[model samples]
Target: MFHIGYIRVPRSTWSVGRRFYSSEIQKKTIGFIGLGQMGYPMAQNLHKATKSTHRFIIYDNNAGATTKFTSSNSDTKAVSTPRDVAAESDIVFTMLPASAHVRAVYEGSDGVLEGVTPGVVCVDCSTIDVRTARDVAKNVEAKQAVMLDAPVSGGTPAAQNGTLTFMVGAPQSQFEGVKEFLQKMGKNVFYCGENGTGQAAKICNNMMLGICMVGASETFNLGLRLGLEPELLNKILNTSSGRSWSTDTYHLVPGLNPNVPASKDYEGGFGVSLMAKDLGLAVSAATEVKSSVMLGSAAEQMYKIIAGTEGYEKKDFSVVFRWLGGEKIGKGKGK
Candidate 1:
């Protein structure tokens, strides 16, 4: 919500709420170290946006990722190792699965440390722990490199469309420096402050989202089983105080929201393993902080149940609704 003095500005002015917008101040030799599911399209966006004269060097563990990039954009350079990418790049970006993986990629042989130049910037967009992010930042700093943990929001569609949101954790200088490259891959990029705040923000927000997903699914499932019409119920809930992202935007129960994966058959949006991994991170962080994450814990179990069933590899995290006996989901991946 944007407002000037006392008057509220029109709701239309709202873009993706990214704090801090100063243009590209730092010129860089852009690099991508991890190019997997979400990272693949994101790298492509960057490669397309950056001038051909300034090549975007990419490295991935998978030979297929390198082949795909080489095939699509012949000019984009494919490197054999993370070290090679690091040695050549002024700014290195990593999009990986977990904290341990991030650590391994950074500290292992031919890692970022072996090649990152002094004053080069390192941005890790993996959804990981605040502590681990800080630790990695410190490790990278020892190599005289600036590090930012800029995790993302919105799923693969957002990634492909460049509508993804970035929660960036870094000092002002480094955050502003990477804007040119980040803008190509994300619609909004926030400078949320020191080393791991971006990761913290993403985890906390996703934990709440996970819980909302369960609540929406359970309520709709009960309503449907009681012979209530899902569409009518959805219309009612969407407009009423019960409305939420899950209820209106990504409703898990069938017929509630046609735009969501559930309607098309739960498929690749944010993967189930990803959600379970996030929930696990949330619970682990919660225990460390001595916080009561009762709802997050319950949501984690629900995801576990869904993953344990036949639906594991086929569906999105939202399919936890059907696994709870809500409705038997449709076959095939969401298109």
Candidate 2:
């Protein structure tokens, strides 16, 4: 199921040649598509940030998600299709799951392109392949509308907290025009360059993250087998050169960080399958550029294994810890 959020404004707000009051801000119709785990919270934050005058529209392939959102946010208008979203929105944001989904939402029959008006700004937050991102942008431009590949980082927690980092690939002018809107759902908004660079940055980051998580899992597992306590090892590593985001902020040891996925049996966060997909993207990109990524390739394979394993595919990527033979340190049970 696909979902969209649309924001509408009164016609008088765009009336021709009228002198506007200094305090009168023109309301914009904003559309958000894809109301999955990350998208749901992102749309919630954006909807909260927008003024009451702006009409919000939303649609989702999952009818339950749309119903849940509308039940909470009564002002939002739920639409039937991506095209319907485009027809009523000045700005559209899509946060699909994969490259193929992004393509279908934009290029399929009765898709966003079919209903998009010239000059409308389209922003894609899906972490897709660079080629797909660029191709979609080109098609959106051919329709006389502006499109930006603005994939994000920070996972589900960041999305819910409105602190995700946006890596945007678009012209400076176009990026500047939408910076404020992006800020409503993120803490950092970086203009990464032309189309596809955002996806490039995202894939690179996730690839590194995947590698780091694997390394962290290996280290912790080895340490446990050597009679070193998980918390003790984590403390030493975090305070020493071994410290990295994987070790400090998102440690794979379950009881080390109560807020991270590891503490919850890796139920919610970036899924193992998603991480495997991103690693696959990185491997493909590396191959295309002839860049050697031995560790990345190895990490990709590890994630692929995890994704294929029963009961692990849908869990958080951090479950690599358990998969690597790390001990399960339940909350309040670890020293």
Give per-candidate clash totals. 0, 18
lDDT of 2 by residue, 33-151 (tens): 99999999999999998846467898788999999999999999999999999988878899999999999999998799999976678999999999999999999999877899999
Output the TM-score of candidate 2.
0.91
User: Ten-residue segment with the worst summed lDDT in candidate 1?
Assistant: 15-24
- Go through the candidates in order and give each one's C-alpha lDDT: 0.78, 0.86
Q: Model 1: clashing residue pairs? A: none
TM-score of each candidate structure, all chains considered together: 0.86, 0.91
Full-model lDDT, candidate 2: 0.86
